[model samples]
Target: MPATLPLDLFLGALVTVGLLAYLTYALVRPERF
Candidate 1:
């Protein structure tokens, strides 16, 4: 149970980063991604 907490946090962080990166790319290119 304790290990799952860290795992969920890590995955959430990764998703946040990925979403931010995708948004940045979309803003910069507007059509490529």
Candidate 2:
């Protein structure tokens, strides 16, 4: 269980940031096709 801490945090942060970035990009540019 302890060994998974680093991996878990890395993935969690990656997903959270990725989602936020995607949302922001979408809102900033809605004319993209």
Candidate 3:
């Protein structure tokens, strides 16, 4: 259970960061999307 907790948190953070990056890129270049 302890090991799974850290893995879950890491995956959540990774996904959040990816979403933020994609949003920022889309905002910067709206023409491409």
Candidate 4:
């Protein structure tokens, strides 16, 4: 439905951002991980 489309997009964007941020952090501090 139209109403669920925006929610799906928002969730997808949030997950993508979180993954990118985590990757950046891991790259910055390789010793911890």
Candidate 5:
């Protein structure tokens, strides 16, 4: 099934932000990054 443009964009943005937050947290600790 094909996702609508808006739906795809929203999901993409959501995932991107989630990964970004995770990466930011991981990077914050020098030993963890």
Candidate 6:
């Protein structure tokens, strides 16, 4: 169980970054996407 901790944290960070990028893109270009 301890070995999976890093993987979980990495995934969470990845997801958060992805969501932020998507939101930024949508906000910057509402007509393109």
- Model 2 collision count: 0
Q: Which residue pairs show collisions in model 4?
A: none
Candidate 6 lDDT for residue 4: 60
lDDT of each: 0.88, 0.88, 0.92, 0.92, 0.86, 0.91
- Model 3 quality (TM-score): 0.80
Mind giving the per-residue lDDT tens digits that candidate 2 earns over 1-33? 465569788999999999999989999999982
Worst 10 residues of 3 by lDDT: 1-10
lDDT of 2 at 6: 91
Best by TM-score: 4
What's the lDDT of the predicted structure labeled candidate 3?
A: 0.92
Q: What is candidate 6's local distance difference test score?
A: 0.91
- Tell me how far the alpha carbon of residue 29 in candidate 2 is from the true structure, in angstroms, after superposition: 0.3
Ranking by TM-score: 4, 3, 6, 1, 2, 5
Poorest 10 consecutive residues of model 5 by lDDT?
1-10
Q: Report residue 29 deviation for candidate 5 (angstroms).
A: 3.3
- Predicted candidate 5 versus true structure: per-residue lDDT over 1-33, tens digit per residue: 556568788999999999999988888976975
TM-score of each: 0.76, 0.71, 0.80, 0.81, 0.64, 0.77
Where in model 3 is the C-alpha error above 4 Å? 1-5
For 1-33, candidate 6 gives per-residue lDDT tens digits of 465668788999999999999999999999997
